[model samples]
Target: MRTVTRARLLIVCLLSLRYGGHDEPAAQSHGLFCASADAHPTPFILRFRKTDRAVILPAYLDHIFDAAAAIERKNARRYLYTNNNDSWEETPFNHPSTFDTLALDPGMGERIKADLDAFSKGESFYHRNGRAWKRGYLLYGPPGTGKSSLIAAIANYMQFDIYDLELTKVSNNADLKSLLMQTTRKSVIVIEDIDCSVKLSNRDGADEASEKATDSNTSCKLTLSGLLNFTDGLWSCCGEERIFIFTTNFKERIDLALLRPGRMDMHILLSYCTFHAFKKLARNYLGIQEHPMYLELDEAMRKTSIQLTPAAIAEILISNQDSPDVAIREVLAAFPKDMPNERAGNVDGGKCQLSHNESKQQTFRQTMFVFFQKTKHLR
Candidate 1:
């Protein structure tokens, strides 16, 4: 009887294993492993049945994918930085100037856009030509001109970060090269007031040491040759799709090597305001494109020998934006009588014509002094 009982128990156990004893499947734990600490954390899930396998596994995988995508997006945003003591320091580059909003000549603006577009597409072209993918621009004009504004427009248009290089802060050539290397690809490196930044002369070791000892803070020992090498030399080729811009109030003061054909691919002269540029400002400030006084203002600007900058005109237009007639009248009255000859036709199409005559320079100084004095109240 005991042997029979044992056999019956064994048969019962085997039948239960074959037929499934429990009503639900056992719970199984799944782990979602992340590659980095910065990655989004995924929740643990317990799966039990064929239905759960069909729904829960796929949903968990999708969540992991979404988290990874979020991480990538957070890391992709660029920033503006400046060189500080041989290192780059991040700063806000929130400039509110675009190609449309910028007061640049239409033709010139279009050409700039075309050049940028071509450069952006010239990766294969660069490789084919065996050239470094870079371009340089020299923006030369007097103070209050739109050189800085133009730089801002380029940055905004390209959606690229700016690296405003302060050459004065750099200690030596090595420091300058290091700063350049730290910059990432696809950025505009701007050196504003390049003429005033440093003497930019290649001196002997004794002279360099004496200057360094005399005034370390004011004078930069970096030579013009060193600067050129950094811009167009082998080191520059390390980065691709880069733009270098040098701005100066005195273009004639800059070294010839810097203004050479290959060095500065384009030399944009931001000259005094023209009727065409004035129209742009009018449109920007006042909504009306064709006012009754348009003809009068056009004639007045044509008659005037003294030229005003775009900024000066913009100030006048904005002050009486509500009253275009008043603004036009004020601009006409403020126009100096014994003004210098119109510098050049339109900055966009015109070549830079620098006059080195002392008498002309003296006259310009006096006239500009008076011009600023009158506009000072407007500011």
Candidate 2:
């Protein structure tokens, strides 16, 4: 009879709960026999839990509450929030970014998706491991490497809210803690530009307990220890199924403690563009499988060692959408012959790199066009 209460708590629980009552076990054993087939909707259940009536069931009356809705919560609306006085100021987040649209390596993209799946389904795994049911991601790369886009993609994929935690706006550790505590479960808590967010003292620099109570400097700096606690400490456990994403333009500038395994479980580095990435972007933007200029561009990149960001390459493709030939040729000539040889950096020193790089490409478009125009005469 108590079966009336907890269907979800049991079915999705991965068998964590202890079984109840003698007859309950029998009922579960013969659960299929107890099953009565009735139409039910994923978005809703047209039923009632309790029954109360007299006068011979009181001539039972019920209304057919039939309707249709999206089970993935599309109508529920995703939100983006910013910290405000220990509360979140919400707005509709309509970013169209998704894994499908992302210019990520197929393998890296799949791995990230799989990791998210495992984490979302890891309630029992987390509980059994005696750890908080949360995952921390550190996205460090030069700007314009799709760090923000990846964040959007992740939010869209998980159907989670994005809380853009601006540490500079927070007054103190208490303020930071309050903001974090106010966040709900299944949220992506993002702190972008972590290196530049606050001037975090070294691990051995200041006493965190004292720093927590201290004052405002250029809009109050959150200490390293405080940031650490925010990620891996007791306060972070307040919400379940939370994802903490910390982005830095320069990973080398970050403190060692913050880069630790437990605090930043996944350190993703979105790096410079590669031929493979260019091909994917080409497919997305130009709708071309193979371009005559691809081999020339690829070979030029290998020879001159000029690296570009996806954003930069994308700009070329977009700016010259009418002509794929120009786009590829311009991309080829964009790299300067005298530019220093750079290694286009590895995705990360961790298992998942931006799931996943090197550095920024914000000015690459302007640079590319100017370079192309100047070099066109030589071509």
Best by TM-score: 2
Clashing pairs in 1: none
- Show how many residue pairs clash in every candidate, following the order shown: 0, 10
Alpha-carbon local distance difference test for all models: 0.70, 0.70
**How does residue 327 of candidate 2 score in lDDT?**
79
Tens-digit per-residue lDDT, 1-379, candidate 1: 1222221111111111211332223211222111222332432222234434445446645765776664563455556788887899997777777777667765988998898889878999988999898889999876666888899889877767899998878877788899989988879999998877766655343455433312356555676667888888889999988999999877888878888865788988786676777778888887667777667767676666656667777777777889888777777665554554464464445533556564256446546645674677789
Model 2: how far residue 287 lies from native, Å? 1.0
Candidate 1 global lDDT? 0.70
Clashing pairs in 2: 142-359, 268-353, 268-354, 269-354, 269-357, 270-357, 271-357, 271-358, 352-355, 353-356
RMSD of each: 14.0, 9.4
TM-score of 1: 0.71
